[model samples]
Target: MASAAATSVMGSVIGKLAAMLTEKYKLAKDVERGIRFLQEELRSMDAVLQMLAEKDDDQIDPRAKDWRSKDGGIAEEIRELKNLVSEQSERGKRYYDINQCLTASAQPVLLDPRAPALFQEASDLVGIDAPREEIIRLLKCEEKQHKVVSIYGIGGQGKTTLAMEVYHKITEAFDCRAFVSVSQTPDMKRLLRDILSQISKSDFDQSQMLETVEQLIRTVKECLKDKRIITTTRKKAVANKCCTGIAAQMYEAKPLSDEDSQRLFFTRLFFSGDDCHPDLRKVSDDILKKCCGLPLAIISIAGLLANRSKTVEVWSNVLTSISAAVEKDSPIDKMKRILLLSYFDLPHHLKSCLLYLSVFPEDYSIDCRQLILLWVAEGLIPGQDRESMEQLGRSYLNELINRSLVQPTKVGADGTTVKQCRVHDVILEFIVSKAVEDKLCYHMEW
Candidate 1:
C-alpha cells in the first residue's frame, strides 16, 4: 500500500512535469530528456506498485517499511527535479503558443474514429429531424449567396449528427459537396486537399499545394465555384475560417425537449413503456432527467441499460448509482469512452485547467472572470510575456471553449464574449473521475 501510494504521487508529479514541458517548455534539452526518463521510470514504478497491489489484501503487512529507500537517494532525486521545475518557474518564462497551438496541429490522431451515437440509424436519431431540417432550409434558402451554414453547440449535443443529416439531405441540391471532420488538431493543407478532392469527384493531386490560409481559400473558390461545401467542426471560430470569403452562418443545436429526451431514452431502453412496470417507468424518468436532453448522454445510458433485465429494483438501483456518480456513474463505459477523446486531445497545461473545473458541482454556472481569478490564485494560469495571468487565463478558457470541452452557457450582451460557462454534467463527471485518478484533487458530497 505504501509503495502504491508513493508511485501514485510520483506519477502525478511526472504528469504535471510533462504538461509543463509541453506548455511551459523552458527547460534545456537535457532537462527535458531527464523528465522523459523520469516519466518512464515512474511508469515502471506504477507496474511494481500494481504487482504489490495484486497481493492478497489480508496478507499485506502494514508494518513493512521496506518501501522506503535505505540509501535515501530517492528523496534527494525528487528534490532535485522539484527544484528544476521551481527554478524554471522563478525565471519568469510565460506561455508562447497562444497563437500557434490554438489552431489545430498539422497531424492529430483522433483517439477514437468511431463515435457510436453519431452513426445511429436516422430513425433511431430521435429529436434531430427538426433542427436538421431548419438548418438545411437556411442553407438552401440562400443558395445564390454561396453561404456556409454550420451547426454549433456544446459537445454531446449531436452537432455532428445533425450536420451530417443536413449534409446528406442537401447534397443533391449542389453539383459537388463534401463532409469532413475538423479535429482538435487539423492540418489545414491536408484537410483542404481532402475536401477539394471529395467535392471535385477526382483523385486530386497535391504534390505542390501551397500551405497558406489565403491559398486554401483561393483553391476552394477556384475549384468549388457555386458548389456547396459543408463541414462539421466543434467551434464557430473554425467554421468562420473554413470559408472566410464566403457567407458563414452558425446554427446552434437546440437541446432535446423533455418529451423527446424521455421518448428517445425509453425507446432505446425498451420498445415501449407500456411493457414496463409502473415503478420502472418512474425510475426511468428520473434517469432521463439526469441526462438533461443531451442525446449522447441519453443514448449512452440507454445503451448501458439495454442488456440488463428490466425490473423496478434494477432500475431504481441504476438510478441511485447514476445520481451518486454525478456523471462518473452509470454506464461509465459510455461516459468515460466518449469524454476521454476530448480529454486526451488537450495539451498538458490545459489538462489540469479543465479538470480543476470539476471542483464545482455539476450544472453549476461559473462566472468567467471569477473562474479566471481562481485559476490565478491556484497558479494554474502562468504569466506570459506582456500578458497578465488574467489574460492568459482567459485565453486558456477560450481555447477550452473552442475545443468544445467546456461549453459557454451565457454570453455577454454583445453576444461575442463568454460571460458565463458550465461544463456538461457528463463531462463534469469525467473531470471528477480523472482528477481522482491523477490524484489532482478530490470532491466530497453529503
Candidate 2:
C-alpha cells in the first residue's frame, strides 16, 4: 500500500513535469531538458518501488535494502538502483496470457455492434427530438448563406450526441460536411487539419503541407464556403467564440423529462417497462429518481443492472449501494457514485480495458480496430490463437458499449458494426480519476 501511494505521488510529479514542458509554461529549452531528465529518473524510481512492494522481505535482496537505507556509497546505491530497474523491466515482460486463463466457453457472447446505436437516433433519444429539430431548422441548410449554431450545456447533458444527431440528419443537404470535437487544449493546427481531412474533396492530406495555424485556418475557411456547421461546448463563452462573426444561434441543452427519463431507463434495462418484472419496479423507480433525468446517469445505472437477474432482492441491494455510497451531495458526486458502482462490478480484465482508454484525449473519436490492436499489444488480450485474441477484444469492447460505459460514434460500411467510438466526457473524467488512483495511467491538469 505504501508503494502504491508512492506510485500515485510519482504519477502526479510526472504529470506536473509534463505540464511544464507545454508551451503555456514558456519553459526554457535547457530547463525543459532538465525536467525531462528528472522525469525519467522518477519513473525508474516508481517502477523499482512497485516491484519491491510486490515482493516478500525474504525475496528482496539485502543490497537493495542497504541502498534504500542510504547506508551504501553513491556508486553502490546507483548500481543497486540500476539492477532493481533491470529486474523490474524483466518482471514487466511477464505478461499474464489471458488466453490460457479462461476457456473459450467461459467468455461471454459478443454483443451486436448495432445494439449501441439504439440510442443514437432522434426517435431513440426519447426527450431531445424537439431540440434536434430546432437545431436543424436553425442550421437552414437549404439557404445559400452559411450559418453556425452552438449547443452549450454542462457535461452529460448530451450536447455532443444532440449535435451529432442533427449533423447526421442534415449532413446530406450540404455539398461538404465535417464534424470535429474541439478539445479543451485546442491544437489549432490539428483541429484545422481534421476539418480539412473530413470535408475536403481531394484525397491528399491537405493539412499536412501547411505548417502554421494561419495557413491551415485559411485552407479550412476556403473549404467551408456555404457549409452548415454546428458546435457544442460546456461553456457559453466558448460557444459564442465558435459563432464569432457568423450568422449564429446558441441553444442550451436540457435534461431528459420525467416520462422520457423513465422510458430511457427501462429501454436500457429491458428495452420496455412491459418486459420489466413487477417486483423490481419500485427499486427501478427509486434508482431513476436518484438519476434525476440525466441521460448518461440513466444509461450507466441501467447498464449495470442489465446483466443482473431481475429480482427485488438484487435490485434493492443495488439501490441501497447507491444510497449508502452517496449522500445528498451535488449532482456530480451522485453521478460519480453511480459510475463507481458500474466500475466496481466489472471483472478484472474489463477494468484494465476500460482504464486503458484514459490515454486518449477528451472528445476524441477512437477507431475500433485501432483500439483492439492496442489491447492486444498491451498484453490485455489473451487467447490460444490470434483469431480468438482479436475476437475476445471485440467482445470486451461490445460489452462496455452495451453497458453504456463507452459511446459508439461511427458505423462500418456494413451498417451493423460500430467502427468508431468515443467515451462520454463525464465517463472519461471518472475513468481518468480511477486510472490515476490505481496507477494504471498518469494524467495532469494545467
Candidate 3:
C-alpha cells in the first residue's frame, strides 16, 4: 500500500511538470509568432514614416534624419525585449491581444483592380459606358450659382450614375469638393466625414465628425467659394436641409428619354464588334420600352439579351417574361423588381450583407471602413479563427462592392485607397422597403 501511494504521487508530479512544459512550449510558439507579426508591421510603419519624412524634408532637418534612425533602432531593440518578456510571462496572452488590436486598428487598403474581374469584364461587355457629354453639361451648369437643375426621375433612373459622371468631370475645376449620400436612415456624422475626407484627400476619423465638418466647411469656403459641390439624397427634405449653404447647383437626374433608351439598348445589344442579326433592334427596342427608360431595367434586360439570340421576337419575348415577373407600380418599382431578381440570385451571406446596407438612407455614401465597422458592430459579419473582425468585415464589404450593388463614389488621392460606397436611390428604396416588409427595421417618418 505504501509503495502504490508513492508511485501515484510520483506520477502526479511528472504529469504536472509535463503540463507546465507544454504550456511553456505554447507560450514560446505564440511569442515567436507575435514577434514576427510585430516586426513585419513595424517595418511597414517605418516605411510609411520614412515616406512622410521624405515628403516633409524641410520640416525634418538633416539632424532629424540621424535622430529618426537612432529612434528606429531603439524601437527595434525595445520590441525584441518585449517579445522576450511576453514569452516568459502570462503565456503570451498579452502579445496575442496586442497583435489582434494592431490588426483591427489598421485601415483597409484599397488595391487597384479593386473590384472583381467579372464586374470589370461586364462593364466592358455591355459598353454601359459613362456619358461624358451629359456629365460635362451638368458640370458647366453647376458652375453657375442659383442654378438648381433637378435630375428628377423615379428610382433606377440612373440619377446617381449621371451625378457621378458629372462629379468626375468637374473635379478638376474645384479647389475643394464634397459628395455625400443622404439615405433614409441617415448617419450624418459618417456622411460628413466621407465628404470632408474626399475633399481633403485624407482619412478623417469618424469620431471627429464635428471637427472634420467645421474644417471641411472652412476649407471649402476659403478655397472653393465658387467651386461646385454635389450631393445626392433620396429625401427632398434632407437634401434641402444639407444643401442650404453649400450646393451651388442641384441637378435632378431624370430617366433616359425614349431616344436615349433606344440608343442605350442598341449600344448594349448590337454595339459589340460582332454583327447583330438585323432583327436585333426590333427586339431590343421592345425590351427598352418595357424598361421605361430606367437604366437599371435597361441594363438588366440587356444582360438577359446578351446571353441569347438577338432576334426581335426573342427580345420581345424577353420583355414579356420580365413584365410577367415584375408587378406594375411605377418605373422605379419595376426597376426594384429587376434588381431584386439579381439580389435573390446572390449567395446567402451576401444577401444578408446587402440587406444590412438598407439601414442607410438613400444616396447615403458609406466609407468602406465605416461600413465594415458597422457590419462588425451589428454582428452581421462572421468572426475568423485567425483574422480579426475588422479584416473579415473588410473582406465582406469588398465582396458586396465587387458585385456592383454598391457603387464606388470616391477614391482618395492616394493612388491606393479605400473607395466610398453609395447605393442607388432605387436600390436603397428597395432595401428599405424590404427591411420594413420583413419587420427587420422600423421606418421613421419625417
Best-matching candidate per lDDT: 2
Cα displacement (angstroms), candidate 2, residue 328, comes to 2.9
lDDT of 2 at 211: 79
What lDDT score is found at residue 84 in candidate 2?
Answer: 54
Clashing pairs in 2: 99-382, 99-383
Per-residue lDDT tens digits of candidate 1, residues 1-446? 45544554565566666776774565556877887887788677656566666676556565423554221455445556666766655453443444345433433222111122223367666787788778877667544556667665666777766877887777667766676655344566777777777766443554145668677768776776655555655567776677577676667667789888877766655545565667677788888877767776776566446536778777777677666656554433434553564466578988989989978864567999999888877879754442466767877776676555666666656544677887766577788889999998976643
Of 1 and 2, which scores higher on lDDT? 2
Q: Rate the local accuracy (lDDT) of all candidates.
A: 0.65, 0.77, 0.57
Model 3: worst 10 consecutive residues (lDDT sum): 1-10
Clashes of each: 0, 2, 14
Q: Residue-wise lDDT of candidate 2 within 1-446, one digit each (tens)?
A: 45555565566666666655655444446877987897799788878877876877688799876544442243344445455544543443342224234453476556644347555567777787798899988888556876889889877778888888887887767666778877667787767777777777472275677678888777888777777778888899999898889888988888788788888887777777788878877888888878867888888888888778888998899899988877686666788889999999999999999999999998788999899989998889865457877888988998888788998878777665678998988899899989999999788655
Worst 10 residues of 1 by lDDT: 108-117
Q: Write the per-residue lDDT of candidate 3 for residues 1-446, one digit (tens) a residue.
A: 22222232333333333333443334444655664565555455445454544545466668755655565454555455445554545454566567668756856534423332212332332223445354465546524453333443456665655666566556776566676655555555566556657655544553354455566555445544454555554446655664565443444555677776765555555554235566565655555666777766765555445545656776677667667876466776677676776566567766777888877766566888888777776767655432467776766665555444666656557633446877766667777788778777877865
Per-residue lDDT, model 1, residue 291, is: 71
Give the Cα error of residue 108 in candidate 3, in Å. Answer: 27
Stretches off by above 4 angstroms in model 1 are 1-120, 201-203, 206-214, 231-246, 325-446
Between candidates 1 and 2, the TM-score winner: 2
